[model samples]
Target: MIAILSDIHGNLPALEAVIADARTAGATAFVNLGDSLSGPLWPAETADLLMREGWPAIAGNHERQVLTHAIERMGASDRFASERLSAAQLAWLAAQPPVLALTDEIFLCHGSPRSDLEHLLHTVEAAGIRQATEAEIAERLGDTPAALTLCGHTHLPRTVTLADGRTIANPGSVGLQAFHDDHPLPYIVENGDPLARYALVRGTGVELRAVAYDHLGAAAKAAREGRADWAAALRTGLAG
Candidate 1:
């Protein structure tokens, strides 16, 4: 089985827990959908850990912003990550592609095939965040000849099967669980429980897994970094 992880956002405790869980589940390969080292907690340490493994990864919007844009061109979170990461870490982020065609049947991307910033499986309709229709997701995916596409950016566990039998899965976040974004749109995303999230995929089957961890410690780390918002999210998994 392959373990899929994303949006780690520098929380080392959560990442450690998720890795242990996936490993115990007999996952032999690890794929990290990026936005890995873009938070206040442990970007440097997390980067070092992941780099040692050299797991395959795709770049997320935060990774792109950190590598390609100046700190002045980034938002608060991106700026925070970029400012503290080592030069080698920045280079590693720069080396990742927006998409990875792992095999003829399997693919990996941070968000969508075309843009790492687009949510291929989600949309804001009315007042609620909803999963996109099969057609909508297929349209966003374009002509990628993949039966299973793995993506993460939303930090929500999701699985969508298109009419053509294409499956897309977001394993959720390994670190941060709840967050609010207001760049291209305004929305709040939450999981309501402080647990490390990851995914296991074998064949066409997908499992969204959550691993219990010491969330209070993660919250303390975020708080020490002066990110009270992140601290609250880490602790409660609720929107802060």
Candidate 2:
């Protein structure tokens, strides 16, 4: 079995709980879909753990932004992570690819195959956020020939099988559960509860799993860091 993780966003406690749970579930290997260490929680510590484990990982949009953008111009989450990460940690993030092929039949990407900042399974519309059509997903997938494509950017857990037998899955977020985004429009993604999330890939199926952790402590830590919005989201899995 393979354990799939994504969008950790620097909450080490949550990651730990998810790892333990994955082990108990008989996951023999692990793959990370990035957006790993950009948040107000434990950026450096999270980096340490992930780096030591040396799991097959990719770089999400936030990782690229944190590395390329001026620190002053970064958002709170990226800026906070940038300030806390050591030089080696920054280098580690820089080393990851925007997308990867785990095997001849399995592909991994933070978002779309074409763009780390784009959502592979979802789209932003004037009406609201919604799942992308098969055509749209196929377009974003481009010429990648992997039968199983794994992506995570919207922080939503989903598994979709294309008409051609290609499967795409998002395991959800391991840390932050809810977030508001404003790009072409404004929309929010929420899991409706505070829990650490991940996925188990077994045989030809995907299982979304949520594990309990010390979320209140994570909320208090975010509060102490002066991000009440993060604190609220960590507590309730709802944006403030």
Candidate 3:
């Protein structure tokens, strides 16, 4: 079995819990869909763990921002992680591909096939974010021939099977459960709980799973760092 994880965002305890749970579920191989260390909790330690694991991984848009943007211009989360990551860790992030074909039939990307910042299964408009229509997903997907495509960016666990029988799955965030984002527009994503999330791919099906961890401890650490917003999200899975 293969386990798919994404948007870890530096919460080490949550990642550990998800890893243990995946192993228990008979997952022998792991795929990491990135956004791994761009948070206030444990960027350096998370980097250490992920580096040791050496899972097949891809880079999210945050990875690009952290690597190329000047420190002064980076968002607070990216800046915190960038500051704490070592040169080796940064190198690892730099080396990750924005899109990866995991197998002849399994494709992996941080977001859509064309843009790391675009949501593969979602659309944003005047009303805010909503599930992407089949046409929109097809447009973003282009002509990728993979039977199964995996992406993670919005931190929402979802699976969509197109009318053509192609499947797209997002394993969701192992670290963060909810957050507000502003780019082309403003939006919020919330899973409504503090458990870490991932997906198990067995046969041709994907199972969305959540695992319990010491989320309060993580919240405390974020509070200590003066990230009350992160702390609130960590504690309640609701964006502050």
Candidate with the greatest TM-score versus the true structure: 3
Tens digits of per-residue lDDT, candidate 2, 1-240, equal 999999999999999999999999899999999999998899999999999999999999999999999988999999999999999999999999999989888899998998887888999988778989999998998888988899998998988999989999999999999988997589888888899989998865889999999999999999999999899999999987
Best-performing candidate as measured by lDDT: 3
Better of 2 and 3 by TM-score: 3
Per-residue CA lDDT of model 1 for 1-240, tens digit only, reads 999999999889889999899999899999999899888788889889999999998889888888878777887678888778888988888889889999898999998998888887888554757778887898889998889999998899999888788999999999988998864568888999999999999986899999999999989988888889999999999986
lDDT of 3 by residue, 1-240 (tens): 999999999999999999999999899999999999998999999999999999999999999999999999999999999999889999999999999999988999998999899999988777778999999999999999999999999899889999998999998899999999886699888889999999999865899999999999999999998999999999999996
Candidate 2: worst 10 consecutive residues by lDDT?
A: 183-192
Give the Cα error of residue 91 in candidate 1, in Å: 1.3
Ranking by lDDT: 3, 2, 1
Which residue pairs in model 1 clash with each other? none
Error of 3 at 57 (Å): 0.7
Judge candidate 3 at residue 94 and give its lDDT. 97
Which is the better candidate, 1 or 2, if ranked by TM-score? Answer: 2
Question: What lDDT is reached at residue 205 by model 3?
Answer: 89
RMSD of each: 1.2, 1.0, 0.8
